[model samples]
Target: MTPTIALLLIITFLLSTVGLLVLIWSISTNQFSNSQNAARTIFTPGEEGHSEDPAREDTSAYKGDSKAAKEAFTARRVQDQSSKPAVLIWLSSAVFWLLIGSFYGLLASIKMHYPEFMADSQWWTFGRIRPMHLNAVVYGWSSMAGIGAVLFLVPRLFKTPLRGTPYAVTGAIIWNIGVILGLGAINFGLSDGQEWLEFPWQVDFLFVLGGALCAVPLLLTCARRTVEHLYVSSWYFLAALVWFPFLFFIANVPKVFPGATGATVNWWFAHNVLGLWVTPLGIGIAYYIIPKILGRPIISYKLSLIGFWSLALFYSQVGIHHLIGGPIPTWLVTLSIVHSVMMSIPVITVAINHHGTMWGSFGRIKESPTLRFVWIGALMYTATSLQGSLMALRSVNVITHFTHYTIAHAHLGMYAFLSFILFGAIYFIMPRLTDREWPWRRMISLHFWLVAIGILIYFVSLTTAGWLQGLALLDAKTPFLEIVQMTIPYLQARSLGGGLMVAGHIVFVVHFIFMLSRRGAMTQGPTLFRVRTKEISQ
Candidate 1:
């Protein structure tokens, strides 16, 4: 490695190490002593009076409030006035993007096996459509849905009205504009040539502005919060809110760092988009939804503290592992791998807290659509993160990196883990926001099974094909072209899986549209799968 690259890698490693040490120090102290209270904050109601500073919620402002106040709040069950309008606007847009992204994903999958399928149009070229599928799904579908969830959950957690609703609404609108503009630019051959950061430089500013706009309302709502203790979910959401804009702008700024440095930033930014931003929101949603629905507190607040801090300290550094064996210094890649392994600590801790809370709720999983999907996602998060840690090892990376094995792992995290959480969030939040029931229980089940089966097929095929391809490539006698040919069948399987997933998304959108229309009435408590007689009798 060159001296300059080595110097940069050393500096980055030292910075990450210092951050980890600081987090460990804070955890060692009693900074998070009130873990139980943190969990209780959401269930606890606010005083009738609001506070100008959110810090007061933990202090004298509501010191005199009684159990009677909580009873009153529960009886009243204040409507989610802060979140409704903005949520509807943002979530509706998210569903729209999900459809677009899934469709593009299917197209991209088809082009993999059938390069001749749409060869004539530059817009439909696999190169362009592939990134469109990625950006549209990540930035357009997942991020927007996450923002909507945060908008909903933050105010509800704080027992405060959503502040700056107009601004949030405007931000959501502008954010959609950015997604549209960015994707449109890419389709028209204006990509920035970065993986997951393909949107042109000019388009990045719109997202930055849109994100800043969405963030202000969340922060202001926090400032106006009435909860005495910050919930673990709140910490994740707020930290993500702060971290994303910082990464978004830094990674998108042009000419600031050129050539190899820029490539490093590109990979860093791309991976952190998953690790830092969207992953936290998904976990935070789980943190809120699991406990609220099951009426059980998380197993240990200290564990939650550990999980959050470890994730914050470790995840940012782990992103660079994507650059393993690349031009970057070996030290940087080594740091990333070490951090990736350290990540398993947080993953295991979170698994314990989430699953331990649901130990006896197996029946509820079948009964509640939200619980089933979210619970499955929580499990998948454990699976995916652990797999990621394993993949970071040099041995595993040799076979997986740049192969379909990597693709399978990516989907396992994004579609299976993150999308499942968002799916559950939409199902849970929609009825609350629209105050209308989903039209059909069977449809929800159908939607679940289709996507579930589809992804299983997709993941299994790609992983097997990727491992074979990697092994083949490693052999000098094996022809690269023959290895590519061998993957054709798996590519076909992938396309088939993509088709099924697309069909599932279609069912979801149709259902969501019905919910929005006059046809969807608040007719049932929740459109769950049919309960067994034994379960019902109990």
Candidate 2:
């Protein structure tokens, strides 16, 4: 085996050993029990039975007029009237970008089927349109939607009204405009030609401006929070808020660094944006949804802290793994590979914390749309990180670099993990926002299955096809054209998967619109899978 491949195997073994040890520890500590009590906690209303301590009692001292504690609790439960306008602005921007991104995906899929579909238009060329598709999906749809959710969720999680609501609205507008102009400029043959940072230097200023605007609401919400205990979700959101703008500004500075160092910095920023920005949002949603649905405190607050800090430390340095075998220095690649392998420390900690928390609640997975989506997303987080670490190994990179395998990895992380978690978040948030339950439970069930199966088809086909192509390229006898031809069948399979996923997205959009219009059925409890009448009787 090549040194890179051998190193990857060693890392895999180490992660597996660590996971086994964790499982053993959990069992010994009685943390491995089923979490059935937790799942019923959400529906248990009032502070009587659910109070953390039984000794606390209602007294005249606590009920005194104009008391600070009472005022704080009231403030926590009340929604801010001013925040609605800002949330709507953010939501509208997110939805518009979602549609544009879907269309770009559709166009890109068509080009795969017919390479010369838009031969006459320079702006429609494959290279230009490909990056546009990526930017549209990542920056336009995902980032916008994530921010909208954050605008809504951060305040709710913190139990406080958003501060500077108007600035938040302004930021959403600016962000939307920036994305549009950046995409337009790139499609119109103006670009820096960097992989993920394709937009020109001038356009980046708008992003910085918009990012500054967003920081205002987040900072204010944090300051105004009534909840004494900061939940794991809040931690992730706060970290992401601090991380994104700093990385964005540093990465977009033009010609500030020398040749290969620039490339190294760019990739570092690119990969971390995924880890710091998108990954945190997804993980935060999971942390909230799993516990909220199960109605339990997180399995172990200490474990979560370990996972969070480990991820922050390890992920920041692993981006150099992407540059392995490139013109970059050898030590940089080795350091990255080491960091990538060490990432398992965080990945396993998070997996244990999330999965272990659900130990006895597996039955609910069948009934709760939010739980099902979030669970799958949580699992995929582990899978994708493992795959990423393996790919970082020099030997694996030699085979997988520039192939569809990398494409498969990206989709697994972005679509399967992050998007799935977001879908769950939407399901959870919509009811709270609209004061009505979902109109169609069956549609949600269908949405879950379609996307799940679509991801399976997408990942399997492309990964197998990519591996074969890579091996063929390595073999001197196989011609390059034959390798290209082999990928067509896999690409066709990918389009099929994309079709299913898009169909599910359409279902979700319609469902969201129905809920927004208040056309859905009214219900007292959450729109859960199982009807648990009197299960948690007050």
Candidate 3:
């Protein structure tokens, strides 16, 4: 076994030992006797019987706290207004980088089929631009937008204004600068040479510093929250805030591990960035948006908690499954496989909560742009997660590991799931932030169709192509050149799909700019999709 595996074994053993001791200590002290009190601590006085969503059914009669609830609701809106400046900065940065990233992604996709498209410029080579696209979207768009949503949610959830707006704004600026510098470095061939950690180590500190600065206000706000019981969404936000920086720091420590150990660390960091960092942000936002728009609570609070804790337990280990066939120890890979399968717990639990919450309210999607985007995103989360868990198995990994199938899966998670949720959130938050309706509902609908159709085409074409490619690889009679030729049509299809998504992004940016400039429709009602009188269900 390699040194890394040995060290991991030792660490696991020690941790298990410590956990066992803690369990014994707790049992001896009769800690389980008051487990109900601990469980009940998650609920505030007069809130346990009420729906968690602020827009929930009339629960004022149940708790006899109608006046208090009204006051709290008003305070949340005021807090949202106060959070506008800083939140907008983060969101604006997110949108800007999103546009930039989409173009880079399109260019990269085009190069896949037509390699000569950008051959004239070394700066635009696939190697450089691909990493540029990844970083721009991952750190630039997704992180910034997720942070913006968190900034917006925290104040309302905690019933307080964000504590340090100036610092958060500074952090957004610094974060953008880091992305710019990192992408520039990639363009010049100065990458650190890994899939996710492509940014040179020199600029890594900017992200660390910027993320820390952004985190301070949220942490302080949480600490000083007016609400006694922490909501499930808050739990996700707080955990993501802590997980991301720590993961980034450890992963980019600059030549700490070498050879097999380095590869192990690389996959561990890469996968966790998705499962731990971004997944929480996406799930947290969905948990809020789904119920908030539906005017109801999740189907089961206990199930939500189960999902959260199970995710924390299973996701951290599941990352190692990416290195299943590598030089790692067999036992370690098996452990990860076990965790991967166990991930079904959280995935099903969350699916039940999110989809069940939106059960009877599916018709609302016609009138609510936010619900349309978010609901589809939530569905994709279930699809991509189950796909991921299945792929972690050795049998499935052998076929799909190095194929474009993985790429399809990644986009399914990142774009269809995470980006879609972010889009919905922006749609919901922007009008409230600007105090203006979107100028055109048609534009929003067009944007959604373009991207939605694009991803559908993108996912289907690549999944089929990758499966065929995998089969050919397994066949000894198949020529490598023949496999390459077979995938060309799919690659071209990917570019076409990417082009549509890019167009959608452009439309979104234009709409966002209009809203920010206060040029939106001068109407009091929200800019919802037009529905025929007969189609209106509620």
Candidate 4:
């Protein structure tokens, strides 16, 4: 490696080490203690006597003298602690966006086969529709749904009510509006032309505003939590809450950096939006789902901490690896590659923790829809990260770069891993929110099979086809157009996979709508797969 690459690697290593040390110190100092207490504690009036220190008397001496005063304080606290309304609004926003985004994706997929499908319509053109599909999925579906999930999960994990429900609601509204305006602008030819950050400067302000609004509730909820043992999921959620706004704001700043610097920052922000924002939300959900299904605590809290810190440390520098073989400095690419390989530490740590937690519970997966989705998602996470590390290598990138292989890798991470986890989280959370079981266990089972099989077909065909295409391009004897022609069959298969996947999504959406309308059968317990009488008795 060149000196610059060596220096970059050293810098990344030092930063990660320092961050890990700080995390260790914080854990040792009990800083994360009482994280879950905020859920119910805010409902109680003034602080009570500490069980550990009886001499520490209640401080509200004046209020203690009046029974009415104490009751009023308690009532106010309950009002402050409620989060149901905020969660509802956020979820509604997510569902609306998800439908719209999914349709855009369908349109884009079809346009790939029939480029002239909407030839006369400017708004429906491929360029406009492609970005719309991305923005819709990233901002509309994933981010909104993630926020909703976190809003629900954090309170339960922290054992506290969300502190600023109104603020969260406001943020959701602003975020949805921003998404609409941004998509509309891009369709109408008002784009800044950045890949992920395509929205105009004015629209970026709304994102910042929304982000700031959301952060308040998260911080306040963390501050007021009552649970003493901060779960691994909570840690990931809290860190992501802190990381996202910082990266978003820094990346969008105009004219503050040179052209190359801006490109580096933009890609960094683009990549981390997945790593820091979506990845944490997905991982957090997995952390909750795996253990909840098994009715056990995590396998090892120490491994979780190691995974969390290592991810934050190593994943931050991976964007530069994307710029490898480009005009960017060789040092930057080399540094990114090293950090990319180092990512194995976190991936392995998380895999060990998750697998160890579920070591004896594989049988449970058959009966539990949530477990099936989550376990598959967890496994995909390992596969994608390892694939990513290999792809970051210069030798490997030479073949994979600008090919369908990258697309396959992206879907492996985004759809199979992250989207599956989100689906599992929704399955786990919706019953609690609605106070009703799912409409049909059979529908859920069908949904899982369709999506699982569809993704497998999609990945296998495209990956194999992409590898051949890449090899053909590299070979001097192979004709370029013939290589393109060779991919037509795989692309057709991909469309079939997309069709099945879309059908699965439609099934889920229909089920969700029916559940929301209270049209499903009323049941007391969670909807589980029917078992033989003997097994049920056991």
How well does candidate 4 match the true structure, expressed as C-alpha RMSD?
A: 8.6
State the lDDT of candidate 2 residue by residue for 238-331, as single tens digits. 9999999889889988989778999899889989989889998888778867766665666776777778878987898888877778898786
Q: Which scores greater on TM-score, model 2 or model 4?
A: 4
Q: TM-scores of all models?
A: 0.89, 0.84, 0.89, 0.85
Q: List the global CA lDDT of all models.
A: 0.83, 0.75, 0.83, 0.76
Candidate 3 residue lDDT tens string, 262-312: 887888899899999999999999987777665456777767877997898
- 282 Cα displacement, candidate 1 (Å): 0.2
Clashes of each: 1, 4, 0, 15
Candidate no. 3 TM-score = 0.89
User: Which residue segments of model 1 deviate by more than 4 Å?
Assistant: 1-30, 44-79, 523-538
Candidate 4 lDDT tens digits, 1-538 = 4776678679869977987898799889986555434222322232222111000111112222256535543443343236666766777777777777767777776777677788798989989987887888888888888888888877767666788888999999899899999999999998877788888778988988987898888889889977666678887888888888888888877768677777788789888998898999888888876765554556667777779988997898898877778888786788789989999999999999788888977886787677788889999999999999999998988888878888788889988998888778777666656645677888899899888988898899789888888778889798888988898788778877877887888888888888778776554332221221212210
Better of 3 and 4 by lDDT: 3
Query: Sort by TM-score, best first: what order?
Result: 1, 3, 4, 2
Please, what are the lDDT tens digits per residue for candidate 1 over residues 387-458? 999999998898788899999999999999999999999887876666466778788989999999999999
* Top-TM-score structure, candidate number: 1
Worst 10 residues of 4 by lDDT: 50-59
Report residue 194 deviation for candidate 4 (angstroms): 1.9
